[model samples]
Target: MTNIHAPEVLISEVGPRDGLQSVKATMPTADKLRWIDALAAAGLREIEVASFVPAQLLPQMADAAQVVQHALRHTGVRVMALVPNLRGAQAALQAGAQKLTLPVSASPAHSMANVRKTPEAMVEEVKAVLRLRDEMAPGVPVEVGMSTAFGCTLQGLVPEDDVLRLAVLLAEAGVDEIGLSDTTGMGNPAQVSRLFKRMFQEIGPLTGAAHLHNTRGLGLANGLAAYEAGVRTFDSSLGGLGGCPYAPGASGNVVTEDLVVMFEAMGVSTGVDLHKLMAARAPLKAGLPGEPLYGMTPEAGLPKGWV
Candidate 1:
């Protein structure tokens, strides 16, 4: 078996932040930490542990600082936090977050609805967050995903040109990396490949992870499409936790266990253990008992003679 130190693909687990935020119940702090440890033990090098939003907006992440502090204890995993604006970024940096991801929605309506700011204003906010990171936590990478990149429930059929333009704008704003997000779970495989390709063309070295959801049940297919398009990093959740909270009909994120299986089966090293990854689901279920978990691989088990 190849070592995880340099896997062919990077699985960035977003269950803690993305998954937890969308759910109604707030997971206990200890349970959250245990889950993070479980994920790290399963070989996920990066984990979006918490979102630094106002407690009023997301009660589930009310303990963002605590979660970030605990997650940082894992020396191997890159502890990431999502911040909607400069204030949230400040809180995340103060809590010792290793990486920062901001959602800059492409749809004007989504931009306003999610963050109470226009798309252009969100870019300015990214610049502010970038400046703060430079002054306080220099070298802590900042990644921004163009949410609603494929389409939006508020605004149907987002123009491809608009998404590409936002990617370039974010790159120019000095964000360390730019990612395309299928926030609405409306993205198809063909669109996923083409948009990410164009994102690479525009941002080049800064093109980052593929943040796709399974609201429409195409998460794995879209992930494969992104991989073939040259995207190496993917954002997934343990049980495909709470889908895009901002999107009305969006369901869950790409399932991490299933995704690792898909990649490893294709001879692509995801650096995650299929056995341990599935086992990690215990803590997740314990944390959110009634919450529905989604993933085909976890339910079906590994195939006979699966590598």
Candidate 2:
């Protein structure tokens, strides 16, 4: 096995899309742009800037196109957007998103509740989206996030077999990558390691980011487990915002600042400056005045004699 402590890791920031969308208040377009710029300036190479859902469905993301256009200005950062179907994919591509992520729930119940489509139906949707991508934007990559890859609140203990099967199906459907998401925050370190190891074995290099939530307070532990399993990319939100609306008691993605601190402290290079990354939270707060942000590193300053 490769050294678990490999020096470089990619911390893909999802705050602009996942974090903001969970809040009640809608962040202004200019403020969203400022937040994205700040995150990029802090060395985040990839950011999910927006989701191309209907404005009525998620008013917070009403400015998805505008946010994607502004995010494109940051040449060093890869602009990403979440798309539920082919129309959303087309909008994202038209808005110049460099990467697209589509969520496919592992639990059949959660799938219907969240996207109103069964898991198999979602796979077909991915195929259609990929076909559209081929016609409209050939080079841009589409990633399928297997949400509820862990146990689901609606349907307990999502069989590992189901998750792996969906992964294979998505890979067969022509996705650029398949990321595992603990959408319900019901995963442990052991489960994370085992699942990610199996994922790499089944899909090889198509394995992508580990999207873990802190709802059960094991976010960092699970992240470390994935790292040990040779997963290099991680998906986290600033201030630990966002959760699946379809999953009860699911809240808070792994906090970006905290994840960065953990990796950097372990001598793993994330290329993200801790102070700059934490400071980016200022713009986030400014955007949504009353929204709450969570991160232990920010609440408690860096340790003494620490570099």
Candidate 3:
């Protein structure tokens, strides 16, 4: 058997959900579908189309079911959605989401403040969702994203032990995959490496993706750090929407354009066509007029035929 480098990284676009959720304007369902179509055409294999929660809470995703249905029409593309609890998971499954992701806070305080539940409570919630999937979804995969794993505004310093412990609990709860998220964007390269290395040691193959924020301008660096530590999947938002409201002026997740450029420039294939990716931005912009878009690669213009 020959050793195969994982080829290219997987860029999971979260713009429709994370990006749109942060903005005041609700992107029209038709425009959202057009954007998703453009993104799929651009070679993004997975896209978080929406979050299944109370529309009163997040009016932006009030049409999550419609968006998920639209995404599912594109064969071969993984349609994912965010669920805060069993209710959202059930809705997403009914909407035909191939994967459902739940945000499990590592900090107890953040968990309570964000989801109104403790970490352990959230773990149980995940278990319940997993059970629902086994009985309902059957083939659908349930993933838990450990948010604020790096640090939190509500809680000053999050302990690594707590993060790892929650990872174990979530795993035992029967989640198919566990993802780490820098919700607060306080993550640095060193911290990222150490945490991921430790996580892999304990959870090993159970680790999934790194959901990073460009809040402090270290999103790409932290992503690289995680990738070097054997992480292949990455979560990013198109045009860097949905910045941490806690951290003003910071971009949401790592910019999809910048992440693709970083990987493709290094001869690592992302399977994402930069030209097509950039072209997809037009529809995204059209969908959310007046919303600020962020990306270095887009501004710098792809370095003269560097595909």
Q: Which candidate tops lDDT?
A: 2
> How would you encode candidate 1's per-residue C-alpha lDDT over 235-258 as one tens digit per residue?
999888876555444378999988
- Stronger candidate by TM-score (1 vs 2): 1
Q: Which ten residues in a row have the lowest lDDT in candidate 1?
A: 242-251
- Model 3 agreement with the true structure over 175-212: per-residue lDDT tens digits: 88898999989999999999999989988888989999
Residue pairs whose backbone atoms clash in candidate 1: none
Q: Per-residue lDDT of 1-307 in model 2, one digit per residue for the tens?
A: 1124433999999989988888778898988899899999998999999999999999999999989988888877999999999899999999999999999999999999999999999999999999999999999999998999998888899999999999999998889999999987899999999999999999999999999999979999999999999999999999887765554343689999899888888888887877788889999899889676788999998877656
User: What C-alpha lDDT, on a 0 to 100 scale, does residue 158 get in candidate 1?
Assistant: 97
Question: Model 2 scores what on Cα lDDT?
Answer: 0.90
Full-model lDDT for every candidate: 0.89, 0.90, 0.89
**Per-residue lDDT for 66 in model 1?**
91
lDDT of 3 at 256: 95
How accurate locally is residue 189 in candidate 2, as Cα lDDT from 0 to 100? 98
| TM-score of model 2 vs. true structure | 0.95
Off by over 4 Å in 3: 1-7
